[model samples]
Target: MSPSLFTSLDVKSGGGTAVFSFLILLLLKMAFDTFGYKMGMNPWPGVFGWYCNPAYRLFDFLLGYTGFLVLEKTDLKVSSWKISVIQCVTLVFYFAACHLFDKQWVPAPFILLTLVLIFAFTLPGGIFNAIFGNRVLTHLGNISFELYIVHQVNINLMNHTLLKWTGNNHLLVFFMLLVISWLMAEFFSLNPIKRFVTKSIYKSKIFI
Candidate 1:
């Protein structure tokens, strides 16, 4: 389903509905994983098989849609104190999950963070808004798609070619990846470079 069709149910006019739909989507995602596994269709855990599954991809797209819906599609009117409480509660739940499951609990952090961000959308004059509402983040957002596409390649290239420069420190390697990926994304976003690539691809008949 296209996100544009449902973009009207936004925070300003439909905050309750938006939150409810977001939760429902979360439940549906979990249900699909559970039933897909029971039916012998979902990928085995940690195998990366679900990445190729059409059903999983649909839910992924919906989640991404709703994620943006909560983040930027509407004008949120939540107070900073309430948002802070939500953040604290989410952190507590995340820590509890990690402790009980004896694992790193990846989804918990993302979901919890999303929840906090949904409410943090309109913290006027607040540090959270000030921190994220910046030119640097705007630049990153502009290149986010390119960054996603090229980040893995940059990581692999750095690991193979530039590890010596960092003395094999993974922390430094991580920074190197960030810088390289941002630079690569900026390069790809340049109009002349984008047109060149598009023309080359068209000449190769890739569009057909």
Candidate 2:
């Protein structure tokens, strides 16, 4: 059983990436979080709700592209002050995400909250390179994508199945899921699998 694939269904102000000025982007995102859906769903089905899914994809794409830009910077310098501010905002977003919001990522608050945090930490001041550029973090980030794809469904299945037989143990369920997800991530990230994927994609005319 894969973790349920679902996005949050919630209210939104929209127009963060375009039309709005700089500050409004952040504001609108936070606003969505504050006003959007307030709960998580059990794994979603193919495709997601209308409002949030496209926004999520755009935000994520921009984040990765921004990281690439940061890494490629030739001579730009980032002030420590800006990094500090971003870090502070990132923490704020995290606080709101965990405490002020509900469990779902796609609905109102969680979607905006989580994405703002990503932007806060990864979007500016060359922090992307400074942090994820580290060898370990980079490797994890690579597999992290694949892990995100495979880990959740299986873990959720495990949790559901185990809860019935073993009753309920938070520690046991979380620990097992974490460990298993890591192993599965590692397996998908292994050299052989990586090469196979690369070659397959390379040979595919669809990519070309």
Which candidate number has the best lDDT? 1
Off by over 4 Å in 2: 1-78, 103-105, 108-112, 123-136, 198-208
Model 1 residue 88 lDDT score:
56
Best by TM-score: 1
Q: Write one digit per residue (lDDT tens) for candidate 2, span 28-111.
A: 544544444433232333344223253344444333433333333334356867776777878776786677544545343444
Positional deviation of residue 80's Cα in model 1 after best superposition, in angstroms: 4.2
Please provide, for model 1 over 78-168, each residue's C-alpha lDDT reduced to its tens digit, 9 standing for 90 to 100: 6677765655565576556667755333242455455455455444645456667799997887776567567755565456567787677
Name the lDDT value of residue 86 in candidate 1.
55
Q: Which ten residues in a row have the lowest lDDT in candidate 1?
A: 46-55
List per-prediction Cα lDDT, in the order shown. Answer: 0.60, 0.53
